[model samples]
Target: MSKFNRPDARAAVSSPVKTKSRASGRTYEGAPGHARDAKSELFLLAVANMVSEDTFYERAKDRDDRFTSLIHKLAVEDADWTARLLGWLRNGAHMRSASLVGAAEYVKARLNAAGTRERRTHEAGEGPGAAAFGGDSLAYRTTTNRRVIDSVLQRADEPGEMLAYWTSKYGRNIPKPVKRGVADAVGRLYTERNLLKYDTDSKGFRFGDVVDLVHPVAGSHSEAWREWQGELFRYALDRRHNRGTVPNPDLLPMLAYNLAFLESAGENPECLLDTDALKRAGLTWENALSLAGSKVDKKALWEAMIPSMGYMALLRNLRNFDQAGVSDEVAEQVAARLADPEQVEKSRQFPFRFLAAYNAAPSLRWSWALEKALNASLSNVPTLPGRTLILVDRSGSMFGAISQRSGLNRADSAAIFGTALAIRAASADLVEFGTSHRPVRFSAGSSVLSTLKEFTSMGGTNTAEAVRANYRRHDRVVIVTDEQAWSGYHGADPLGQVPANVPVYTWNLAGHQYGHGPSGESQRHTFGGLTDAAFRMIPLLEVGQNATWPF
Candidate 1:
């Protein structure tokens, strides 16, 4: 008989245990359909937010490729869906992992299995672009060029056509991250066996062809270089020499080989001395600042590189400019350069950095520098027209790290976002909720770090009671939570306990598979993501309008 029909030895030895029945009137029943639906919601969350390995997708059985299956159907059936999925890969570094690339491959395999006319082909160097359908079909501005290159490298069947796209279609002015990825791919040509296994050396030759087309030499060029490996460097050197500028600054290091070659051949070093390529080499922000003091103009170097640095880099090296012979006036100019409100909106880590700085260094000598940057970054927060109640969940589960490598926890991230919103809103009341509800006092113009110290993790989640304690004459309620509550607080659903007229909106900071969120499958009053984009939904949600796609 089958295992399901047989009585196992372990079953005979074990005592029977009773399981608690779920409360009545709830939609979730732990049924197959329920779990399937939950997985579907998780797949959407993974696409809209960042993908996590511990979530529903990882727990799925080996045969169940529901998520990948859906991704293929969406790619073939709708171009807009394809654009959104591709666009989302640009959300963060976590989104650009190998798992996402594997998903793209699965989509291609499914298309092939169906024997459809839209089969992916590498003919004439056009397999990956086929996946995108066409250049005009999607908006290039929505994503970073580096993400596009990473996606292309992951999906392309051949390197030659991919190289052609970079030269002919993608353009030479690529971003640093994208250039790093491409350079790594090119550098691995001799070492990586699978990169260039084709019969003809046409791809490398084509790349060299493009280089000569762009920057022709007077004398005959040597054919000493092999396929693809040295051609990219050659192209970069030629281009840098032709334009008197380094196209991609990160690729600037490859010019070292050219410098040696030119030196041995009795060429002048003045050609590269005029270019700013050396200043952009892979180096720490502090090291780069120090090096730029002698070789390049300090003001120009600071202006070009400071905006690209992450919040942590900017925070950690606040004193570097001063020590690097940069005048106080120039340092202030660099600080103001990064403090632009428009640029702050594009950064994902400003809130976290601002909070970390606020908490770790309340009396830091350069605290004012970070505060000015933080205020400028938060200048875009729309002022609410009425009283707003902001509830921050500080449960034990939230103390777990958001990423495996990150020291920051979800609670702190929530606090950063919460404190910013509370401080920015026109009229607001801020409270921390865990096992019990309590009001938090954050004085006007007070430091966010000091305010964060006032909040701590309680043992259990009492969301309903917490909401009731703080729901005093407020127009709308915004709860920042993981959405996993214990039993109902005082025997009532959190939403049901609230005043009927007051709409409850849950901002799901953690992308849980099955949320305790009231809206359930119909996301009429729910949103997800770890950024300020969620706040934009509030204005539209108040008028009974659907939330726009935040990413």
Candidate 2:
């Protein structure tokens, strides 16, 4: 039997008997299986740190047949374990975890009683009367709103029932995005269940319900915008019920309205949008061209549409319009904008945005634009006052997809963040570690995309050697990885070699419960997420201040 009472925890180090067997150096239950036990510990470490609940369950189920019972026991009696699991599910969305609904349902099913759930300590925040929903405060409402919506969606079977669940559980705290998601989900469900006939009469699908659900705050930027959107949704539903055809571009949400109008106009909707109507509908020039149907003057429209898109949005969507009427002049203009260092400095997008673009673009034609974006992204990276060293793990496990849908692996994500940090730091050295440590160099005028393409992924996970070899006099050390390092030559203890005065922060791409590297939970820390906000915490930690979750 294992020494620890908890079935899910790591195996204990001590042997059941102090005496060693003659046949083998160590014996357990009269067997020579200590090596196997060591392997199992490594496996457990990997399972514990999976990105989220769904991933944890997937890996556990694949690794052990008895995992169902083990998870049930953990859910029912292990409060700390349950909270940690829930935290992974709740917060992992920004990091690209599977559905929150699925995670909640899994937890609820294994609870002591049916439909019974409780909030955990870290999520509830420490204070008197910090209830799960936290009454009417906006901050508290946002904290629990996403969770409540996912839970309600999982529980309710019908749109009407979903509306009732929303009314009772969410009350006034319902988020606008939650409303849109629910409407779309329920619409699909209704079609599958032959319940679409009941939609017209329901308030949830019509104007009144949409308004009530998304009553935007009085002075917010989108208050008037949301009101106009509500009008369009109402009009569409009303016209659908009455078998009407015309779709007004000024009142409708761009995509759906554009499609409907195109259909009504024999797939040849008018080339021009009513300027007043577009303004009233909060439409962008890009919105007007989204349904241009491939027949419009691509160059003239592109030039005229110059003022319609934001710099970031323009950069993001440039490749999408490559086949359209993009003239050489237009491409040149865009390239010039990209090369402006000032434009790069002003862009709010994180380094990963540029990396993603660099990864997806097809040819040298887009290289200049991508290079500029990379430079701009690096400008946003905060400068560290002291020396910093960054280690990015390129082990095999880091090649797993960041999200099932993103098509981006954890290795690229690590490289993107790691390289950006290195470029931005006033004084820093960057390296990649897999079988062993190696310095990652960027050639002069090299873009993040090009650097990543040329960077080779090594096979083994000699993480300890990487850190130990790179441990110079750096004041701060940042290691980016999935944290699945195997037993290295130096015994998997990279953090142990660092001097006491230096701070080591591990950014866990996969939300695994255990770290192959060390984290002190204080000055030395580990954070999990896809956002650049995690970088903001380093300066705070350097100044000896406690940093709260960036969300």
What is the Cα-based TM-score of model 2? 0.58
Residue pairs of candidate 1 with colliding backbone atoms = 358-449
TM-score of each: 0.59, 0.58
lDDT of 1 by residue, 1-551 (tens): 58556422111111011111222232221211111233234333443333333322233322124444555555445534444545454453224432344333333433343334324333434454434455432222223333334443432222334444444533655334334434333333321112212212444533333333333221122343333334444544454345454323233333443344334323432222322343333233443444444555654555455655554566555555444455566556555645655555555443556655444544344566566667665554566767888888888767766555445676887776677778777777988887887888886577665677888777666777888778887877878877666556656666556665565667666554445544522222565555565566566655455554543
Specify the highest-TM-score model's number. 1
Maximum-lDDT candidate: 2
Q: Candidate 2 local accuracy as lDDT?
A: 0.51
In Å, residue 523's CA in model 1 sits off its true spot by 10
RMSD to the true structure for each prediction, in A, is 14.6, 12.1
Q: After superposition, how far is residue 407 of candidate 1 from its true place, in Å?
A: 1.9
